[model samples]
Target: MLPKGFFHRRVVLTAGLVLGLTGSAFGAAAGNTATNKAPSSTSPVGSTNVTVADPTVPRPPGTPCTVQLFSGVAFNDFNPRPYAYAPPAGCGTRWSKVVLEADFSVTAGRQFDRTATLWLGGVNLYFGTTEEPSSTVAPSWHVERDLTDYSALLRQAGNGQALIGNVVNSTYTGVIYGSARLLFYPASILAPAAHAPDAVVPLGSDPVGNTVSLATPSSQLSKSLSLPTNVERAYLDVFVQSQNADEFWYTCVPDQYAAEVQECGGGNFREAEISIDGQPAGVAPVYPWIYSGGIDPYLWRPTTGVQTLNFMPYRVDLTPFAGVLSNGAAHQVAVNVAGANNYFSATASLLLYLDPHAKTVTGQIERNTLVGQPPTPTIGDTLTTDSSGNITGAITTQLSRHFIIAGYANTSHGRVDSTVDQTVGFGDIQTFTINATTYRQVTDQQTSSDGVSQSTVGGFVTGKYSEHMRYPLHLDVNQVTAADGSFTLATVAHQGDEKNLAHQLFGITLYSAKLSNTVDSDDTLAFDASGNLTSHSNQQSTQTFAFNDSLGGCYRTDVGSFSGAVSSYATGTGCPGQQNRLFWFTHPDGSPENGNAVLGW
Candidate 1:
C-alpha cells in the first residue's frame, strides 16, 4: 500500500560482486573453468552441515524477480484474519520455490538435464573444461563439495542472461545471484521431511472423472538461488493442498535479514450480540470467542503486559511478556482466563525467532479451570516464517478495521448479498502504516429453492487518497430490503501554506450514492469528549465509528454521522408497536447493535 512514489527500483548492489567481476581480464579468458568438482565417496556431498555446489557447476539463483509481500486480513475477518503475501500488481500472484536434493533417482525422469547449473539474472550457467578465450567466463567461486571441505571452480560461458538488478534502470543489478545463495546459512532447525495425504487426481473429462494422488516430500535441494535480499525479508511460495487450507499451517523459513522481531503490546475486550428488543436477534464475531479443546485459533501472546483479545465465540484476555530466550529467537508467555466450567486460565509461551538457521517458532500453551489448579499445557505448533522487512511484506498481526452490524432472523442466512459481516481490524500502530492498504472485494452469493444468485463489487475508490485515509463500505440484505450498498471514504488534510492548500483544495465530497439521483449532501460529525474524529460524513448514510479506547476495547461514541434507510418490512403486520424497523451497528471485533430508539415519521 505504499505510495506509488515510494516504490522505485535502483541498482541495489554496485560495489560487491559487480566490481569483483569487472576488476580483471582474467575472468574474460576463464570461460572454460569447471563449475564445481565432484566429491569422493569418503566425502559425500549430502553428508555435510555445509552444503556447496561442485566447482564445475555454480549455484543458480532459481528465480530472478522482485515480489512485494503483504499479509494479515484481506477480507475474511476470522479472528487474527488470514495472512497473505501478494506480489505486486499484474504479476502472477502464485509464485513457487522448491529446493530438493538432486539425486539421480529423482531427476531421471525430469525434463531438465544437468547435474550442476548456475542461474543468475534469469540466465543458466553451463560449465565445461574447454580452453577457449570467450567473454562468457565463470567466476572462481568455491562451493562445498561435501560440506566439510570447499571445492574450487572457475568462470563459465553463457550468453542468454536475464536482467535482474534494478527494474527502473533496465540494468540488471543487486548482489550477484551466485554470491547470495552461497552465503545463505543452512535451513533453520532441520525439520523432518513432511508428507501430504493421498488424494485422487481430479478430472474434468466430459463423461467421468478420476482421482490421482500426488506426492511431494519436504526436501531442500543443495543449491542456493537469490531473489532480492537487501530488505529484511523472507517469503515462501507455498503450494497449499486443497484439504490443508481448512486451517492455518505454515511452510516457510524465518528471515535472518530482519533487523529485529519484538513483541508489541495488546488490549482489553467487550462483546455483545444485537437485540432488537431484548431477544437474541443476531450475532457476529464481535467479542466472539471459541472454546474448542485447544482447537480454537485464539489471539496469540508472546510478550508480557502486551495484550491481545480473543473475539470469535469465546472471549479471553491475552498478556504478552518477553522470555529469557531473547536471542534472534524471542519468546512470549501468556495467560488465558475466564473463571468455572466456563472460567479457565493458563500460561503459554511462543518463540519469535528470525535467524535463517533458526527458522521455526516453537512454544507451548496451557490452561486450567482454577486459580491454584495445575496448568494443562499443549505444544503450540511451530511456524517457519520471515520477519517483516522495512517496506514490510505484510502485517503478520491483525490489521483490518471493521465493525459488526448484525441481527437474528427466522432463518440463518449464509454470507450472501449486502449481508452485514462482523469485521475486525487494527489501527495505526507502527503495524498499520501506508504499507497497509485495505482492499474490500465483497462477493454476495446464495443458492436456495427460489434459485441461485450472486453479486460482486469492489471498493477501489478507497485506494485513491493519502496514507492516513480511512474508508468504510457496507452491504446489507434482509426481509425488508431487496439489497443495499454504501461507501464511505475519509482523509485528513493538514493546514499548510495557503497557496498549496488552495491549489490542492480541501474537504471535497467526491462521490455518494443511494437508491436514486438524490444528492444526500447533509454533513455530520461524531466525536468523543475530546472531539477526536470518531466518524464524520457528508451524508449518503455514510459513517465512521471510533471506540472510546482504541483497539476496539471501548465503544463510547458514534464518531461519524450516518443517514440511511432500511426497507425491510416486519414478518407480520400484527406488531403492537411502531413499524418494525431494524437498525444494526457492528464493531471491529464483530459485536452487533442491540439498542433501539424509535424515530418518529
Candidate 2:
C-alpha cells in the first residue's frame, strides 16, 4: 500500500546478535580472558549491564593477504537484484576477516547501510550491520571483523562465500555501490593444542529443510556427532530465521525500549537459548535489520512487507561441555532454540577444538546462571488508522514502543548480571484535504535505541548501545484519473537521520563510539493510464556526519542534485575523513568535525 523503501524499509524481520566493535589491537587474546562493570544512572533503562568476561582466542598465524570477493553496482527502482561473492579457492582455511564497503552513486551523503551474511563451510555466518572501527556512516563506507572466533567455519578447505542485497526480492532499489573482501592470515600458526577447529558437524536447517510449516512450534533439535577424540572445547554456531521477520524490531537502537512495533501483530522480541544434549550452554540476542523489507522468498518474491525467509547467525561457547563429548564416542548433541509461542526455528553445528595428544576435555560444568526458562521481553505497541483506512487525514495519531530483557552470567571471580533492552521505533503519516481533487500527505518517523543490552558476562564483558533511524516526509497528490492510476504526486520531500552507538568493557581496551548519519531529499512522480511511470523527475540533497571514527563515519563529496532519469543524477566522493581514526578515544587533539554546511545534495 506504500512505496518501496518506505514502509518496507522498516519491516526487517531477521534475528541476530548485535556485536559492534572495531580497533587494531583494542581486543583481548582469543581465549576467553577472564571479564565487567555495572550500568550508570545515565544509562538507558533496561540496558545490558555485564559485570565481567573472558576474551576469545586471537587470530591464527598466516601470511596476511586480502582478496576482493564481490563488487556492487547501482540499482534501479523495484528491480529484482541478487548477488554473491565466491572467495579465491584454497584460501578458506587462511581466513581472518570479511570487509564490506558501500555507498550510493548519485544520492547525496546516503547512509550506506545494509545487512549481509557470509556463507562458510555449511553455515551462514552473519555480518550484521557493518560499522567501521569507530562507528560512523556516509556515502561509500565500510565495516570489517576478525573471523578468528568462527575460524572453525570460515577456515575450511572450501574457502568462503557471501550474499549481498535482499535475496527474497531486490526491492531495495537504490544505486548502491559496494564491495566485499576477506583478509587471510596463514593457517601455519594455529597451535595444535589450543588453536583452530579440529572438527565440524552440521545438524541441518530448522524445520528440517528451512521450510517452516508446522501447527505447533517445535523447540528441540538433536543430532549425533561421531568424535575423533581428544577434543578440548566446542562452539555451538547457529543461524535462525523467524517466520515473522518483523521481530527485527527488537534491535532498534538509541533505545529499543523507547521504540514501537507499529503493527498490531508485529514480532518484537529478544534472546534465543541453545542447549547441548539437554544441558544449558549458550544464549544470544535476537536483533533487528531495519533496511530489510520487500523480501518474500516463500511467496516467490511477493511484493509486500510480509517477510518469510530472512536469517541471522549467532554462536554459544560449548567449551564447558567439552569434557562430556571427548570420550571418543558418538554423542547426541542438540540445541533447543526457544522464542514466543512456537515461533522458533534454527540450524546449529558443533565446532570442536581438539588436542590430538591430550587425554580429553577436563573443563566441568561448575555452575549455571539462569534456571527455569522464561518468556521473551516485548516492546509495548499501539497502532491507529483514520476513517479513510490510511494512517492519514481527519484522524490524528500517535504510536510508541519501549521494552527490555535482563539476566546474568556467573563465574568464580565475581557475580555478573546484566539487563538488555530496545526501543522498536515510532513513526506516522498524515493527510489533509485541500479539496476533493487535491490532497497532501506528510510522514514523520523517529527510531532510537539509546538502551539495548545484547549480552554481558561478569568480570568478562557486557555493554550498551544506541542507533537512530528517523525521518520526516511530505507528499501531495494534485491530480488523478482512475483507480490509483494516472495520478500525480506533486512533490515529495524527506529529512533523514541514521546513527549507531556501542559502549563496551571487555577487560582489554574499553571501546565506544558515536556514529551518526544525515539525509534529505525531494522528489516528484506521475503515472499514465497504463500505470507506467511517465515522469523521470526528482531533486534530492544529502549529508552524513560522525563524532567518532571507529564507527566508519565520514562526509560525502557533493555531486550536485539533478532532475531527470534516476541514473542520471549526481554521485559523491564517498564518506570523507580520516577513515582510520584510532580507537581508545584517540581523535586528533580536539579535532574539529566537518559541520552541516558541507551537507546539501
Best by TM-score: 2
- Residue-wise C-alpha lDDT for candidate 1, range 103-132, written one tens digit per residue: 111110101101122222221112111111
Computed on alpha carbons, the lDDT of every model, listed in order, comes to 0.16, 0.34
For all candidates, the clash counts are 65, 71
Instruction: Give TM per candidate.
Output: 0.14, 0.44
lDDT of 1 at 142: 28
Candidate 1 error regions (>4 Å): 1-264, 267-335, 338-392, 397-535, 538-601
Residue lDDT tens for model 2, 1-601: 2322222112221110011211111110000001111222232122111101111112334455665555564432323233333444655453433222222121222112233344445454433321111122212232333344445544433534443332112321224344555655544434221244656666654211221221122455566677755654466666544333323322221133122222223233334556555554555443322221211111110000101112224444454455556655677766543333334445666666666655543333444443343433323222334454433332222334454434332223223343434444333333333333333433333333333343344344443333333333232323333455444444433323333433444422233334333323344444454434454344433333334435453322111133311111111234344232222212211111111011100
Candidate 1, position 270, lDDT = 13
lDDT over C-alpha atoms for residue 392 of model 1: 29
